[model samples]
Target: MSLSAITLLGAAGEAPTLTVVGEGVVLVPADVVYVSITATVQDENLTVASSESSEALNRTIEALIEAGVDEGAFTAGRGRSVSTIQTASRVCNNSTCVVVSDGAVNLVREEVTIRFDAREEALINRSFEVARSEGAEAGIAGYALVDRRAAIAEAREKAIQNAEAEAGALASAAGLKLGERLEIFERSSPLIREPSYAFDPLGMRMTDLFDLSWPVAVDPFETASSAEPGMMEVISQVFVTYRVSP
Candidate 1:
């Protein structure tokens, strides 16, 4: 059919609120992966601990970059903090004043973060393995895909198409031809859920009490293949006003 001919049949004088629901669905492969990891250090002396922590974190960051992570993925902490070891004081009921004994505190923990964007799913899987093996000591916080706008849009169209199909079916069953829609509206946002991260306790742990240093490794495996794909769904509704033949 000619474009003009089709448009002429569906033209509206004012704002046309055709209550005809249409649904459509489209599936697109996940295009990005994100990794979150933290580097931590600990020691008996705050100064010494801070220094060692900084050094270790620097090494970890260097390792990630050397392993192909970009500089943009590396993020370090603001400052060093002296974490105090505190014990609750006890008061004794006596005629004399009780001696207050506050114990000395000695300990420091330094932390840094590392992240990367994965364009290739397999590459992402490989990066996970590299992070754990080389620099990840405390292990990865988790991983995820960002910006799902495109997937949602696809699902929304599918949902609208589904609604339209239902409306047409009902009209056909009643021996009536579907007519102009008076109003159409989206019911809700499309749902898109995807699995982002998985953990293997055996692959991650903590060590080096003085430095609070540890090594982390991620298995190079096809996460997408191993895991089930998340669902994307859409929903919409439309109202139509048709003139029935007497």
Candidate 2:
């Protein structure tokens, strides 16, 4: 049920007033998406590990550019390390499997990541496909809105308008003339059902990709990763109080 109230708030400090809450919603397409491709290698020799990782990383970048993604869109990835080195320990017993010695690193692992922004749906799908084919793990970082402030402002205006209209209807229903707005309050927030892959850093949802009515990749010639763009939802709520004329 909607929240509403009639209280004693008047010109003489004791008259009837009507209060109501209103909400506004706005839907906007996703303007950009964050994509990450990481090439990882593990070997007993550090040089070999590092060299192979760089090769895989380079292949990923070349494939993305060849697939039509802008080279300038790429950025240094933020994760483990650009040149991170870790150590491996020796296990003493098979049953216990305890670290017997903290000796020199028996194995070395290297990870190189590259991140970029994709504006077009086809490019985003292509980026994922090409990166994965090049022996790199690919994933979506998150969805973003370039015009976030504008969308919020429009939703707020609609909320205020809706509050006024509802307040007027309530006052007239109680056999009183709608006078003037006594008070207005706003504590609204934008709400969206964004997935937690960016939050968890492991997986993403197809909800954004399939939620919209973009064409499914059924054609043999259609280059795609079987995904599409998603939308963002913005909402604002407002409370308004109006004094009634007897």
Residues 1-246 of candidate 2: C-alpha lDDT, one tens digit per residue: 123444555566676777777666666766767777777776656677767777777778888899987877776543433344455576766577664443333232233333334357677788889988888888776666766888888877887787777777777777778877888777535444332323222222454354332112121232222223466656666777877777
Distance from true position, residue 195, model 1, in Å? 6.2
Q: How close is candidate 2 to the true structure, as a TM-score?
A: 0.59
Worst 10 residues of 1 by lDDT: 1-10
C-alpha TM-scores of all predictions: 0.48, 0.59
Instruction: Indicate which candidate wins on lDDT.
Output: 2
lDDT of 1: 0.46
Q: 40, model 2: CA deviation in Å?
A: 2.5
Tell me the number of clashing residue pairs for each predicted model: 29, 0
For each candidate, the alpha-carbon lDDT, in order, equals 0.46, 0.62
